[model samples]
Each structure stands twice: as structure tokens, then as C-alpha cells.
Target: GGTIHIGYFDQHSENLLDAMNESQRVIDYIKDVAEYVETADGTQISASQMLEKFLFPGNQQYAPVYKLSGGEKRRLFLLKVLMSAPNVLILDEPTNDLDVQTLAVLEEYLEEFNGCVIVVSHDRYFLDRTVDRIFAFEGVGNLRQYPGNYSLYIDYKEVEAATKKAVAVAEKSKETSVKPKKSERVSWDKNKQRKLSSKEKREYENLEKKITQLEAEKAKTENELYNAPPGEVSEVQKLHEKVESLEKEIDTATERWLELAEINS
Candidate 1:
């Protein structure tokens, strides 16, 4: 029932091209929306000034829309939508076809925007930088709300998975109720006293090297995740998974190394 203005940006910019004349100059296209618009800081700027903020220079502003590059056209369309001054912005896959420079500027603009931004994107880095809350869609028409960003949501899921695994192991142990006999326990202790086998010695040396390599790889992957730029959704996700895999490998190798060390001692 409340009055709210909505601005929608479609990933497929071709559909919106009908509203924009290819023969029209970029500055005229924006001026058609508004000659002057107020920024979030309560400062009024003209159409050309606003264009410059969006990375359009004086010469480029006078060029026809048809002469602009594909990325530039996409940026112009986005600026047009924002210049209309809507209270709510709905961007669908906005990162598609946008260059890194434009994406960085857009992130900054969203940070200062007073309106509500509803972004539907697969870009993990974008979501982590922009939104504080997440609405995850599970299968079978179930939608869940998380109170944090994309990274936080991933942490929650990992914790949930570990908890479930632990509970299942506990339940299985209770059901089995198995214990070794006294002779079996003595045999195990004797086995621990024996020196490492030839094959195990080789494996033990390899495990130490493997663990060290895995640790280095994990550190590099973590640094990549920390410094990754925007619009790298698939790369970021892959780096996260690689880090997890390396951690598991390090743990397993360390356990084997300790086993061999105790036997050699």
C-alpha cells in the first residue's frame, strides 16, 4: 500500500534498447531522463557531471549510442536507470558483460545508495561486498533467510555438515557397542612397539613432504580468496573448495606421519 518507485535493470540489455535511440548522443540520452539529479550526499549535479562519474568522458558523452562499445552501452543503460531516482533497484545478473572497472564503480555506488537494492546474481564476490543478508532458495519451494553475507552463509553450512556427521557417528557407535578383548588389546600394544616397515618408512617420508606442500597450497588459496576482485564468482568458489580440500589432505598426512614417527621411536 505504501508508495515506492522501482527501477529494474535486465541483464539482457538488448530488450531495453528499443527505449533508447541508437542515433541519440549519450549525454542527450541521460538528459532525457533528467537534466539534473541529486546524489545521496544532497548535492545536485548536471547530466554531464553524472556521466563522468559513471566513467563517460566529455568526448564520449557526445558520441552516438551506436558508436559506444558493448560494455560502455551497458554502463550507460545502468546510469540511465539510476538517474531516474527510484527508491528500489532490482538488478538481475548485473555483473554479466560488465568490465572490472564498471563493476568496482557500481559496488561503490551501491554502498552510498539510500534505496533498497535487490540483486539476483551468481557473483559471490559481489554478494559478499554488497548485501548483509541472504535469501537462499532450497529445492522443493523452500526459501531460507540467513542473517549474514555469502561467506557467513557458507560457514554456517560447513558447521551444519560437520555437526550432522558427528551425530551420525555417535549414533552408530551406540548401536554397535563393540569392544576389543584383553588379548586383542595386548596385541595392539605390541604392534605399536614394532619398528616401521620398509614401505611405511617410505610413506612416512612422503607424508611429511605432502603435508608441507598442502599447507603451502592452502595458504596461497586463502590469500587469493582474500584479494580476489569482483565479478569472479566461479573462481572464488573454486578457491574456497580448494582450500578445504588442502586442509583435509594436510590433516590426513599429518596423522600418517605421527603414526610412523611413533612406530620408529
Candidate 2:
């Protein structure tokens, strides 16, 4: 029954990107925090049970899944997964080749899944919408598990990484401000310690202040949502569509901190 769940590229030609994109869409829909799910009868459904009851109902097989443009293919692939009828789904990178419209459809289905879902994606915007938690791949051995969805993950991740970066900067400045730990006896150990002038001292203080303020601001924003209505309609619903914009601020700050770290290094 799941085999009828056709996931194919719309532009089924030599366009490797589209093909890969189609595959990713299907995979991402299966992740642990997914909102969509498959049932015992092999029926794909959402919280509203709209896919089988409406969108692709009445034996309405997917046309775009067989052949279409990159954008169209992505839509079909997502629909297929939404209807695959599984108890648990895992999706990885489901946004490739999707236009804003198709992405919306996929996001809606995800916002609709009910079972355990796990998704692997780098699309911050998509992640912010569809996921409840994040298993972000940081490096070869580091995959940070964030409590909230991607947006929250980004916020928390930035705090974690930025705080580390800010700490590094503070340490470097502290080191530069210190007189070389009483010059060593050996001539080879007599490396000169760079001294911070008065201006540098003031600048360092300003940086510290700015970092402290940013930390407080981030905390305020996060806490604000807790008291402000978390939305009675749905779990994935409260996060307004403007989440992408909100995340941008954090991203910008993270980048700045990273840049400062580079300068200090």
C-alpha cells in the first residue's frame, strides 16, 4: 500500500537537483517530531485527516509525483509521504525544489502530522514551522539536541555558541590586558604581551556591556512567549508566520559574535 506512495521529481530528466530534492522531501516528512502520520489501513493523514478525506481523496492518485517541474515534483513527493500511512515518519531536507506555495503545502501537512517525527534539515524557515524539536548536525561528532523546534533550536544554539564565543573574546581581551606573567628567566620565553591602551580598555567594557544586554534581550523574547498565549488552536500553530523574521535577529547576532571571535583570535 505504501508503494503506491509515489515520490518522484517533476522534472524527471537529468536534473539531479530536483531528483535529490524530491527524495529529501519524502525523507523529512518522516522525522520524529512530524505532525503527519500513516494509519493501520495504509492511509496517510494529518490531524484533520484532510489528505485522504479531501486533497488526494477518492482514488485521486498523484500526477505531479510521476512527472513535473522541480517545484511540482516536490509537492507530489510530500503529498505521497503525507499519505503513506505510517505510525512513525522520518524526513530529511523536505524543502528542496519547492516554491513558496509548495512549501506551504508541505508545512501544513507537517503541522498536521500526529505521530513521532524526526526531520533532518538546514532550512531554518521550514524547520521553525514544522518541527517541535531539533537534532541539528553541528559537526562530525556533534549533533546538538535542542528542546524546541528549529527556531527555538537556533535561538538556543546561538546562545550556546555565541556565549562560548563571547567568553573567548573576553578571555583574549583579559589576556591582552594582563602584563606578561612576570617575564620568564629564559630569553626565548620573553614574548611581549600586547597592552590595551585606554581606548581599548573602554571599548572592551562597551563590548562586555553589549554582550550582556543581548543575553538579556534574548531571554526576554523567549520568556515573553511563555506568558503570552501559546495558542489554543494547535501546538504548531502559536508560532506566528513571522517567526522567520524573529529568527533573523538571532542569526545576525550570532554572526556578529562569531566575527568578533575571529577578530580576537
Candidate 3:
């Protein structure tokens, strides 16, 4: 009944407002409960009729791109995706820019969809809702499959990675202690990575969790900032600084995690 594009954040392109034809198709379908809509097709909906009372719930109201709040723009783009009825949805980290309400709307819709849904997300909350299987890119140029939601997959994956890494480290220790042949390379390799050890695995998991929490907190702060009184210069300035700090934290955490992951790859 709907098309869901879950992929790298903002993959929906800026032309969303121009996809009028497809947008109309979606409007006609959801007409039973439709309140408002953005860019879709013209056949199914006129721009004037696109107005919806159901625009994103709470303070995170949906608006046209130029008029939208940051959160609203995020949801509007997602709404645009649903306008194109796709039988098989492709998602890449769909949770990245979503607010909780928007995320819930998507989760509800995807759960009711009749076709297959492939979600690529690092958000545990999202994966637990829409995915029943996990296709994880395990460390060290490996891909592994697990039959469970994100939480289970995380647990299983960390253990597997640790087992592999520890074994590799242990093997290196043995080679050095026993004195391997001169032709043999150093026991450790700058590029060679084993599975993560228990300690390392736990640390990685904690980092991931912290990132998720921080993102949520940052979103909440943004919502508050938008809802603050108009022309509240001091409050706006404070929020801007906080947002800047959050951005830095996000960049730092993401870089470190990728660095650790690349070691195994």
C-alpha cells in the first residue's frame, strides 16, 4: 500500500517536491485517513488538497521543505517516499534522522505492508520493530546472518567477533613465545584483525548504545529549541551551542567506531 525507502540518510533527494505524479498516487490511496500531504503525483492529489491535519504529531510538525522544522523536513521526506507505492522496500539506516513519532508511523505502516522489507539501520529500536532477521556486516570483511531482531543479533555478533579476535591474539602470542621460523612475519599484523575480545566487544557495544542515546537526546533538544518562544535570542543561542556540541560528539563517536571496525576488515 506504500513505498518505504530505507537507506543512507537523505537518499530521497531534494526533488521530493517535484515528484507530483507519484505523490498523487499515494494521496488517493491514503485518502480514507489523509489529512495533508507534500510532493506526490498530481492525478491523485492537488497541491491545495494536500494539506493534512495529521501532519506529524506533537511539536515536530511537518511543513514544506523551506517552511519545515528540521524534524518536520525529515518526516516530510519520509512521507514523500510512502507516496510511491513500492511492493519491496529498501532502507538504509532509516532511523538516522527520524523523530520518535515519525519513526512510529513508519514502523506501523511497514508492519502492515504486504511485501518484503529490507532495513539497513544501526538503530536498535528501529530494527526491533520492522526486521525479523539480521544481515550483519560482521567485522573483518565478513557478513553473517542471524535470525532475530537487532538486540539478539548484537549479542550474538559481539560474542562471535570476540571469539575470533581473541583466538587471533592468542595465536599471535603463542607464535612469539614459541619463536616461529624467521621467514614468518611478525605475530601481529597492522592490518590483520581477529574477532573482538569480550572486553573490546563490550566497549564497542557501549559506544553504540551511547551514540543512540546521544542522538535521541540531541533530537529532543532540537524539538525544544524549535518550540521555544519566537525571538528568544538567548535561548536560541544556547541551543545552537548545544547542537554544535552534539554534532561534534556524533562525528567523534562515529569516526572511532569506524576506525575500530576497519581494523578487523
Candidate 4:
């Protein structure tokens, strides 16, 4: 989850291939090359079980580590990290070169894992599954905390942006003043009070309903994308496009709703 599982993120550590060069079978590689340690929860894992889980069974188990595919090596390395049982897992870009099956397995493992996971990733699907809270970097050393999954956080951000735009428009409207004509040399004050007309009230209600529907559609799309199999690239891409389109619709509807709401207030 989060592009990397707990204890699965170091890219440039002592090479996995180096360990491969020293070991024979996958089990031997794990037992002899990788560090074996107990988990923070005091759970101990068997090397054979780990080998079977991380790598394929039968011929692949007995195959030399050097003969394993790139994805296999990465998977094995991830198992090694998990075996170490670190209390805190800090990962950076763990999704590169990983197979979909492996990702599914890793996601399952993370779901069951009991440890602190610190992940820095742009994988929205992963973040949605893994993190309950997000610390979003807003540039220039600013960080904003949101108490929800990525999809909800994005919704919050969109609403916040719309609110800001509405406020700006409202403020700008107040800045306008009637310029006194040079010939008249005088001007009359006009009341700036605004209220929703009967027609406008209906429009406001309709806009609010449209905004709610768009938000629900976006959330549904996000959920579908998150649960979608990684192998279905085209389907995932389509869902992403749907989410983006819905966001735009929501933003526009929200802006109109805000304008009406402010006037009615």
C-alpha cells in the first residue's frame, strides 16, 4: 500500500543481486542472506513460508536467485525487509517494477501489518487504501493535514478552492463604486444588498443538488479505481478520467451554489 509496503522502500541498499550471488535456492537466500528478526508484535515467521509466499512455488522455489526475474528479486527483497520486523517502516517509491499480483499480496500484508508506515508517494490508489490521514505538502515548506483518504481529501481541496474563489468574487464586487460624473460633480449612494429571487432560489437548489450528485459520482469512481485490478490498465485509466471530469463538474456547480448562497445570506 502507498506505493510501498511497510519495510519495502529502500532502493539503493546493499544489492539484492549481491545476496543472490551468495545464495542458492530462494529459501536459502532468505535464511542465509537476509537478516532474520522478530516482529514488534513478537511474531516469528518461518523462512520456508516466507519463500513460498513471496516467490512462486515448485521449480521457482528451487531456482537460483540469480535466475529470478527483476520483479522476483524485488519481491524477495521486500520479504527480507518484512522479516527484519522493523517497528517503523519508511518507504520511498516501492511500486516501480512490481507485478500486479505482487502488489495485491503486498497490499494484503500491509492491511494485516501492525506498525507505523511512513510513505511518500503520488499513488492515489495506494494512499487511499493505506493511509487514514494525509499530510499534503503544499510547497514552500507548507504542509496541510486532512483527516481522510485521498479521495475525500481531494474533495475537501476542491470545495476549499471554490470557497476561496467565491470569497474573492464577493470582495471584488464590494470594491466597485459609482464614479461621480465630471458634468454632475455629484453621485448618489446605492444599496449593495442582494437577495435570492423566487427563480434564483429554485436555481440555487438545483445547483446544490447537482454539486452533491457530482461529488457522489467522483467518490464512486475513486472507490472503483482503488479496488480495480492493477492488470486492467485501460479500465483504471478510464476511471481516472471519469474522476477528473466529475471534479470539474463539481467545481463549477459548487461555484454557482456559493454565489447563490452568499446572495441569499
Which stretch of 10 consecutive residues in model 3 shows the poorest summed lDDT?
56-65
Residue pairs with clashing backbones, model 1:
none
lDDT of 3 by residue, 1-265 (tens): 2444333235443344344333233333334334443322324543224324225433323222344555665565565555444555677666666767767767876765555677877678888777766667858999765555666556544544654564475446434544345554454453244666687677777878877887788788766655555334456557656755775676577556554554444
C-alpha lDDT of residue 52 in model 3: 44
The digit string of per-residue lDDT tens for model 1 on 29-72 reads 99999999777888888999989989999999999999987788
lDDT of 1 at 257: 70
Write candidate 4's Cα lDDT for 134-224 as tens digits: 6788989998665556776686577557656755764564456335466534322121265678999999999878877876777787677
Instruction: Give stretches of model 4 more than 4 Å off.
Output: 1-8, 11-19, 33-44, 177-265
lDDT of 4: 0.67
The top-ranked prediction according to TM-score is: 1
Q: Using Cα atoms with residue i matched to residue i, what is each candidate's TM-score against the true structure?
A: 0.67, 0.43, 0.41, 0.60
Can you tell me which runs of candidate 2 are displaced by over 4 Å? 1-74, 169-265
| Collision count of model 4 | 0
Candidate 4 lowest-lDDT run of ten: 183-192
Report lDDT per candidate: 0.79, 0.50, 0.56, 0.67
Error of 3 at 192 (Å): 41
- Identify the superior model by lDDT, candidate 1 or candidate 2: 1
Clashes of each: 0, 28, 24, 0
